[model samples]
Target: MTRYLYKELHLAASPISWWFLAGALMTLLPGYPILVGSFFICFGVFQSFQHARESNDVLYSVLLPVKKRDYVTAKYLYTVFMQMIGWVLCAVLTVLRMTALSGLMPYVGNALMNPSPLYLGFVLLIFTAFNVLFLGGFFRTAYKFGLPFLRFGIAALLLISIAEVLHHLPGLGFLNTTTGERLGLQFAILGGCALIYALCTLLSLRASQKRFEMLDL
Candidate 1:
């Protein structure tokens, strides 16, 4: 499984996918929807899946002396790996926004979402939607991805829009704070989002494996 995942990163993945991780830098922008970074990261993963489909990677993969389930495991692990890298980047940027750069005029006065724990929670939710909808949909045919990814794109956009506007709603304004206001609630939201992400991804992995196993390939 480890070796297959290594192959996924070094060989099966599209080269441009790594470049999309740079979207994490969007966290530095004031008054913009930084959660779009999460969308871009998922788009990057989609491209890798597209590449795999075009190259018949799944057909080739099954030819190897490995368990059918391991193929799904490798893909899920690789996607999680990429998501974590983007998450870490956002986390570091959030720390900067909360500490050294907190007082900057633009960030201080920004009315849009700040790089707060609430923001990270939304990021995780965006990732969760992608994994459950897009990745799970892929294995249903293992050959059709366009519709699955399109569904994920729409879902991610909705998540990003909601995240951007949540803080503007009455009584929930602390979500955009740069100083980590309501720190305990923010962490609680983040923890809950993390749990949702884990459970949904694991369930999606199991479903994908089952679908792949029944594939006639």
Candidate 2:
């Protein structure tokens, strides 16, 4: 199913990826690592759905021999894979940009590259949360513009609100420190994010399986 999804979705989304890449500065200039991580992820998720709709993918996928459950699994796994890639790529770019403009953006680099799990974990959680919400809506209805848009708006609002609240929290001081300075906090943050990511992934897969099974095509 992974191979099949790569053929059906990501392969087709390749062209659209460039449009997202074109706006890379939107994520970079802000010096927010998660926004950078979200850059590739948002594009991948949106393009997959866009291509799926443009291609009448449901009908084509049904014609294949794969089981519906495997289809859901493949789609979610692919999304998670892309999100991880996005995170790593953004992290690398952040490091490179910091090095290239070390004198100009030392503060920006120091803040982002602080290496506490709080920031990294927050990024992971946001991406994972978006996936669960998006896949739940997308698999159920494919690319129905209304449902996807509505769910996306809701997800965006909630996530942004959480970030805003977190930004003002005193606990963020721990996140400001280097990993060596607060190993226990970093461990907890990473562990919690991983646990939540796993749960959300499983839930999204199950929801997709249930929703897709009920669809006529």
Candidate 3:
């Protein structure tokens, strides 16, 4: 299982794929924050699946002793791995934003720009929805409907993120509030994200297993 996951990660991280991963950096700019990074990571999954199907990577890979479940598991792990990379990038950008753009806090909340436990929950929820559409659709149609579903997820995430920034900006005067209140909020958010992460992880893996079994792959 670990080996297969490593293989998937390496392939996804290689050549044009890495270029695609690097492309996620473009979205880390002001206002956009993690939207593009999230899109890029998830988009990388589509690219990999596309290559696997087109190049017979899946067909060839399955010829090994590995079970279909391992393949499906590897794909999920691959996604989780790529998302870790995205989160790291998000963390770095958060640091840069806090230091370089602290004066701009009145306009955008720190939550919008940084890595927090609360942020992880939303990110996980987003990916959960993305995978629900992608893996569910791909397994049903062999990638035929997957891209459209993923694009929809990406576009929706972008729009929602933008809306979040606009809608919440007025309440961010808390940026200047007492440290205790801010810390309390952060802890509450962290707890929420932790719950979301656990639920989504379990559900995605199980769903992928079921979906993979339905496929001829």
Q: Which stretches of candidate 3 lie over 4 Å from their true place?
A: 10-14, 23-28, 31-34, 100-121, 147-155, 158-180
Tens-digit per-residue lDDT, 178-209, candidate 3 = 23457567567556755765576667678767
Cα lDDT of model 1 overall?
0.88
For each candidate in the order shown, give its overall lDDT on alpha carbons: 0.88, 0.61, 0.59
Q: What is the TM-score of each candidate against the true structure?
A: 0.96, 0.76, 0.74
Candidate 2 lDDT tens digits, 1-217: 5577576555445466444543334334543443444534565566766776677766766667878666667667666766666666655654554455435653453443343345456667767766776677777666564566467556655664565455457766555554355657766987798789888888778888998888766
Write the residue-wise lDDT of candidate 1 on 142-194 in tens digits: 88888988899999989988887788899988777655448778989999999
Q: Number of clashing pairs, model 3?
A: 0
Estimate the overall C-alpha local distance difference test score of candidate 2: 0.61
Provide the lDDT at 194 for model 1: 99
Q: Between the candidate structures 1 and 3, which one is better when assessed by TM-score?
A: 1
Question: Which structure is stronger by TM-score: 2 or 3?
Answer: 2
RMSD (Cα, Å) for all candidates, in order, is 1.1, 3.7, 4.1
